[model samples]
Target: MRNHSGHDQADHEGHGGAQPGGLSVSEHGYTLEFDSTILTAGVQPVSFRVIGPDGQAVTEFLSEHDRELHFIAVRRDTAGFQHVHPVMDEKGTWSVELALEPGDWRFFTDIHPVGHDGTMTLGIDVAVAGPYDPRPLPEATGIAHIGEYTVALDGELLPGEPSELTLTVSRNGRPVADLQPYLAAYGHLVALRVGDLGYLHVHPEGEPGDGATAPGPGIAFMAVAPTAGTYRLYLDFQHNDVVRTAEFTVRTATAAPKHAERHHGHHAHH
Candidate 1:
């Protein structure tokens, strides 16, 4: 079945199968191993590698959107989300610098190996040492204000159906008409379910200069809700050579009843 965004049920999980990513460090024959599971606060060095089925580090990978691996780090309480690309060494060890706060964090690695069947998104958790305090998730809202831009999310997430979600961008009450491309698209969207931080695949409806897609004012995305629950969405967009992220908390509606199926099965026992 499709979710409100018209995407397949599997899309809410990860690609290539029904299993979800970021739930475990090892999944579907590939393992996400890190040099250290414990890190310190501040801008620090973080390194990890992907172990293939042969029990060795995978050094070669097919680039996706100009990057071999896309690393996403977020605090456990739905805070501090960063989407970045780490540099891989000759030994397949990937390292990147992240400004981390004191708390538990989860890392998601999205990659595609040259010989692998499809893209793999692996998840692992790391601990940040020091005093820790968790932040409560923000209440559900359609509008997200960050920096000089204000983004208003318009759409409802319905379970087991395809839904169209549009995010409108404005600055100081004026519509933004020129949104620069970021990561090969006008915007990059990442969604995670609230409870488990389950990764959801949110697809952009169109790309920049795609003949019908406008660069500004509104960016459309399509996704399907796998279930009824609250989800956090982060949208990254570039404008005037700088990239910024807008986050939103959304809840999906319960799945619609299948009246037709019920009726079909009720054959009046004649």
Candidate 2:
């Protein structure tokens, strides 16, 4: 499904899914392992493990961004959004505990081995039980690059029109330097409608599709907002042991005009 912007609250009243020992989403053979369940608006604990296309645990080999899996929870109608890190039980199993309202929701983990590009992934999904009343929201901006490795965005419907965005990167009051690669890609950016937090993991094309990742000198991506409204943007990059993130709000306008959270909290700098 092309989930580009804000998710409609009414569209998701009830939802659920089940899979154990990992379920396969792509025919190429990648599998997701997790013990999952559907719950009413309450506390939910879940675990996600990455098993390769060959069915082997490949966590240690993943890049700084890949070695550890992230668990983001958003309400189906797109209300509550939380960025969370799962504890790796050993080298393969990772777990997290969260409390959320019901509706059709998504949990995404985009990580890859240092050199395994195409193997990047999103591994979990669950349905929760609730009274199904979503909160109201203002239109959000799609993502845009506010200069200096900084990015922004806003999302709103321009039905039948295309949604295009430009992102620029700079650092320390300069155009940014070094640009080392992390997770086999030149810097990765993922977008999701804030309300539903659906995943729109995207990258600039022409990038090698091999297991090789891309480093950067400033990167930009173009995409179509499946629908439009308010969407949240997340960017991840590694300079060495550290993975830095710049997040902003952006919008998809039918006409001209536009522009857009991470790392305010005590995020351990790698």
Candidate 3:
């Protein structure tokens, strides 16, 4: 749909159909290939490459958000979220160390090849060998505490509609007004649907140098949920020259008739 950092994908070659990314391993003749799909649990090195239509590892890429590629790893149950950058060799093999647990994890790459008209996100699943115990999704909440900072979310996600979400940061009950720019913006937000792990990467409303934009207490974003369901949000922000992530679980707010609302309330109380 209307995803991808507030840009339309219709102009892209392989993005004719409007849909969220990270649901497939290959798209637009590009495939995400891993050296191995199975690994032992713990912090270890992982390697992978992007094979282009010509069946060669892609080496040239355009930078987006101040980086050539963005790597994301998360458990299938919407736990263990990590956003990190990996180093790519001349042969196009990307290497990074991840603290992986015993479970099924999804690895996503957001990249823009040199010749490609636009950026794309590709995903692959890997099995970490060991005892696997999946955890249930956490309950929805608006407040997230990371270290000594507190982040409060205000707004709702509406299905098939663009919703504005604002996150305010504070420390010890004082507003944080000196947030440094991370990835060319005040903050970066990543949203994944609970079931399919559909991905949406969004940036803030304005950039750091823009005169109208403030580095401050609230970062605003426009997000469109593909459907009515639960979602896990990860916000990466930088302050004091250090980056930190704040996590939150959110549910789409759907408008219902009065009687339906009453029924839902009654059912909840019963």
**C-alpha TM-score for every candidate:** 0.88, 0.49, 0.89
Number of the top-ranking candidate, with lDDT as the measure:
3
Residue-level lDDT tens digits of model 3 in 43-158: 99999999999999999998887888999999999778989999999999999999999999999999989898678999999999999999988889999999899999999877
Winner by TM-score:
3
Which window of ten consecutive residues has the lowest lDDT sum in model 1? 1-10
What are the runs in model 2 whose C-alpha is more than 4 Å off? Answer: 1-24, 65-67, 141-190, 193-198, 201-251, 255-270
For candidate 3, list the clashing residue pairs, or say none: none
Regions of model 3 farther than 4 Å from truth = 1-18, 256-270
TM-score of candidate 1 against the unseen true structure: 0.88
lDDT value for candidate 2?
A: 0.50
True-structure RMSD for candidate 1: 4.2
Model 1, global lDDT? 0.80
What C-alpha lDDT values do all the predictions have?
0.80, 0.50, 0.85
